[model samples]
Target: MLKGKKIVITGASSGLGLMTAMKLVQQGARVAITGRNESKLQAAVQSVPHAGRLSTYVLDVTDAEAAAKTLDRIWREMDGVDVLVNNAGFGYFERFIDAPLEHFEQMMDTNYMGVVRCTKAVLPQMLRRGSGQIVNIASIAGKLGTPKSTGYSASKHALLGFTNALRQEMRGTGIIVSAVNPGPFESPFFQTADPGGTYVSSVQSLMMKPERVADAVVKAIVKRKAEIDLPGWAALGVKLYHLFPRLSDRIAGGMLNKK
Candidate 1:
């Protein structure tokens, strides 16, 4: 469905972002992927056939000005962006006090404002063209905050709100805004998030592969679904929590207690 489409995916140096780019390229899309690491970005495009269809830009989503400027330059080079995947973000688990304020600041900048900046960078053009796609890689953390994920969860929660609000504002326009909330996925996330390895190791059995999550994201873009929770069951739990907050809190507390 994406053949010949001009698409951009941020955070494509590794994990789900890279997997999503690979999948889209396989579907014959012209992909312009961005990352903070230029070498890794170059290496990503090295193995693909029709490599001419893929381009790389070194970007840090936290820098709104740079993100806007780069996207503008890429817009001219690519002709125009038909789809944009906002996937640049990471987090570290910490006791709210153990981590310095910078940790939370970085998370908000990369996770929430990053989406805001990128969307603004491309939205005007999309609205003028009257059609486009914006896919945000949020998490189940957005739906329900987990212990040790205070900073991470807040950022995602803010992202979810931004997405929903933007979706409403874009009503009657041809632009489609969607958020994909995935559960824990197997990736290098823990290497950065924990560095110590113990927490990641304990939860390895519960993690889904990046490729599977990427598949769901691509499908959501094609179908223009508003919100999707990976694994499906997690989505159910999120809804139930909203409907039964008090009960959910007790149940959630019990579950954490057991662990």
Candidate 2:
């Protein structure tokens, strides 16, 4: 179903975004990937099985002006974007007190405002065509705010809120707005989020494979699923947290403090 469809993904230099782009290319979709590093984007292009079907753009989603121009260029270059994946973001894990306020500001800028800017750039064309899909790469942290993820969680929470509302607005418009909320996966994201490897070690047993999560992302796109939470077991915790907030927090306190 994805054959010949034009898709754009941000942060495709590495991790889940890169994997998803490659997977889509493999499925015969034309993909345009963007990243802050030009060299890394070039490297990602080389890694794709069908290089001709993949294009790269150097972009920093945090820059609203540049993002608008770059996304517009991509839309024209690719003929049009049938799907857009808002996957550009990073996380840093430090206590609210120890972490500088600047860290949170950066996170909010890149994770929340970035999505807004890119979505705005594409929504007009999508509305004109009456069909499109916007997939926001949120996190499990968005649903259940854990220790040491205050900024990251807040940004993702905002993304989730925006996605939910956008999905409501897009109903009956042949446009799909979805959020992929995944648990900690084996990706370079932890390099910054858990430099000491403490949290990764603590969640070693629960760490998911990027390949599996990439498959789930493609499935969500094809199925037009509203939301996806990786590792069914972890999603159970989110449900429990919603049902019993105080009790869930108390019971999960130790586990949540791995960082």
Candidate 3:
């Protein structure tokens, strides 16, 4: 279904973004990938066998001006973007009291405001065309708070709020806004999010593969699903938490503090 479609994905240097770009390109989509590191962006383009189907841009989504300019270039180069995947974000897991104030600011800027800047830049074109799809890479952490993820969870929560509201506001406008909420995955995310390596070891068995999450992203885009939660068991846990908040905290409180 992605054949010949023009797509843009942020943070495509590695992990979920890169994997999803590969999947889309394999399905014959023309994808433009952006990342903060130029070397990594070029490397990602080289890693793909279908280089012709990919374009690379160096973008730090935190900079609103740079995001606007880079997206304008993408529109010019790709003719127009049919889909946009906001996948650029990082997590730093630290206790709320011990964490530095800057950590929270950085998370909010990249995980929440970054999406805002990119969406603002692209929405005009999508509106002009009257059809588009926006996929926001969120997390189950947003749904249920966990210890040591105060800032990260808050940022993702804000993102989910924006995504949900935007989907409603865009109703009947021919634009699809969807959110992908994945649980912990095996990726470099933990290298920074858990620099001490404690959390990864604690949840090694539960870490889903990046490829699996990427596959779900592709499916969400193709199916235009409103939302996707990875690893069915984890998703069910989130559902149960909503259904029985007090009971959930009592039953699973200890497990949520692996970090």
The per-model lDDT (C-alpha) reads 0.88, 0.93, 0.95
Tell me the lDDT of candidate 2.
0.93
> Between the candidate structures 1 and 2, which one is better when assessed by lDDT?
2
Listed per candidate, the RMSD to the true structure in angstroms reads 1.6, 0.8, 0.7
- Best TM-score goes to which candidate? 3
lDDT of 1 by residue, 1-259 (tens): 8899999999988788888888888899999999999999988888666778889999989888999999999899999999999999999888776888999999999999998899889999999999998999999988887777889989999999999999999999999999999987888777778788766666667778888899998988889899889777777888998999899988776553211
Models sorted by lDDT, best on top: 3, 2, 1
> Worst lDDT window (10 residues) for model 3?
42-51
Highest lDDT: give the candidate number.
3
Question: Residue 12: error of model 1 in Å?
Answer: 0.7
Off by over 4 Å in 2: none
Give the lDDT of residue 125 in candidate 1.
94
Output the TM-score of candidate 1: 0.95
Off by over 4 Å in 3: none
Q: Quote the RMSD, in angstroms, for model 1.
A: 1.6
